[model samples]
Every structure is written in C-alpha cells, then in structure tokens.
Target: MRFVDEIYRLYKGHFNGDEEDIVAIIVGILEEQSHQDLLKLVAEMDEEELFHMLATYMVEVMKRKVAMDDERPPATLTH
Candidate 1:
C-alpha cells in the first residue's frame, strides 16, 4: 500500500466520526501556496526522502509548538 493509504488504513479506526482525513488536516494547515503542490512533490519522493522530510518537518513543528507554550523555554528558532 502507499504510505498515505497505509496511514489512512491504520488510523481509520481511531478517527473521530467527523474526522475522516488526518492527512488532509496536516496538508490543509500548510501555507496556501504549497497546499496541493506539496503533496504532489511528496508523492514523487522515495521512502528515505519521505522519512527524512517527515522527521525534519515534525521536529520543526514540535519545536515551534514547544517554544510557543508559555511554560517552556524558547530558543532562536527557524524552519
């Protein structure tokens, strides 16, 4: 199965009744310019590229979230 299809399958059971597409939520929140284009680019990448991309993107997201949390410490941050 494709990575996205597999993710949908694995999480299908855990999704809330109104929350059908977890991947869409992720993509939707991205800046408007790359919204659909990003997915197209991602689709052409190999597994290794996907892994690194996801890991890097996730870590950056997490770092930003953590930094924004008032209870946490912040450093000069960049994506």
Candidate 2:
C-alpha cells in the first residue's frame, strides 16, 4: 500500500513507535480496501458522494476524540 507507506514516511519524524504497529493500527481501523479498489471508488464517485463520505469521517473523528478525552484526566500546567 504505497499510499499508507507514503503517509508513514512523511510523518515518521513526528511519530514514535514500531512501524509495524503503526501500520497495523492504520490498516485495522480503515476499511480493508486495496489501493486499486480505492482508485476505482474515487473514479466512480460523484461530488455529492465524496462530500458525504468526508463529512461522515469528520464526524466520526470528532466523536472518537470526545470519547477519548472523557477517559483522560484533566490537564494542568506543570511549570
């Protein structure tokens, strides 16, 4: 998956973890479509379908962040 590899390479400087673990987490969370399947899907999409998909993803990300925050302690300045 060149797309996945490219993203990993681009952000490796900022991320610290086993590369395999990172890749596993990413591939596990996303729908298991190959790059070619993704290309076909995009090729066949109308603007409305793409927009709706993006909006749904954003909502899911926001919900996950909120849920994660609820599980953590409140932050404090430690200086």
Candidate 3:
C-alpha cells in the first residue's frame, strides 16, 4: 500500500487525470491477485529488490511507448 501511494505521488503530476484515479487503477490491478500469492511474493522480496523490479517494469513500459510513438504518423496542420 505504501509503495502504491509512492507511485501515485511520483506519477500523479506527470500523468493525466486525478491522483486518486491513478492510485485506484494501480491498486485495482494489484487487487486482482490472490492475497496468498501477493503475500508470498512480498515475503520473498526485500524493499530494494521490489524497487528494482518496479524500475525495470517502468523502463519496459516506457520503451514500448517510445516504440509506439515512433510508429505513429506525424500530425498535419490545417488552415
């Protein structure tokens, strides 16, 4: 939960929509996992390991977004 809050605080200004909405989306995805699974994963990871995992995930997401942007056609100006 604290990690989710940190994510919201870090990204809220950079992303579209309300901070609460962003937090909700993150938490909602997390809620889809079984509690036992989540606990098992959490128990296996230390704080630093979790941070690195999230950082790696963020980098991958950014790479995909950049690739998508590169594939998009340029906008045309209309008079």
Q: Best by TM-score, which number?
A: 2
Question: Candidate 1 regions off by >4 Å?
Answer: 1-36, 71-79
Q: Candidate 1 vs candidate 2: which has greater TM-score?
A: 2
RMSD of 1: 12.9
- For residues 1-79, what per-residue lDDT tens digits would candidate 3 score against the true structure? 4655676787667568777777677777678879996787777778897899799889999999999999999889999
Weakest ten-residue segment in model 2 by summed lDDT: 1-10
**Which residue pairs show backbone clashes in model 1?**
none
**Full-model lDDT for every candidate:** 0.69, 0.75, 0.79
* Residue-level error in angstroms, candidate 1, position 27: 15
In candidate 1, position 69 carries an lDDT of: 97
TM-score, cand. 2 vs. native: 0.54
lDDT of 2 by residue, 1-79 (tens): 3555666787767567777867675666356777887777667767887798789899999999999999999999898
TM-scores for every candidate against the unseen true structure = 0.42, 0.54, 0.49
- Per-candidate Cα RMSD to the true structure, in Å, reads 12.9, 12.0, 13.5
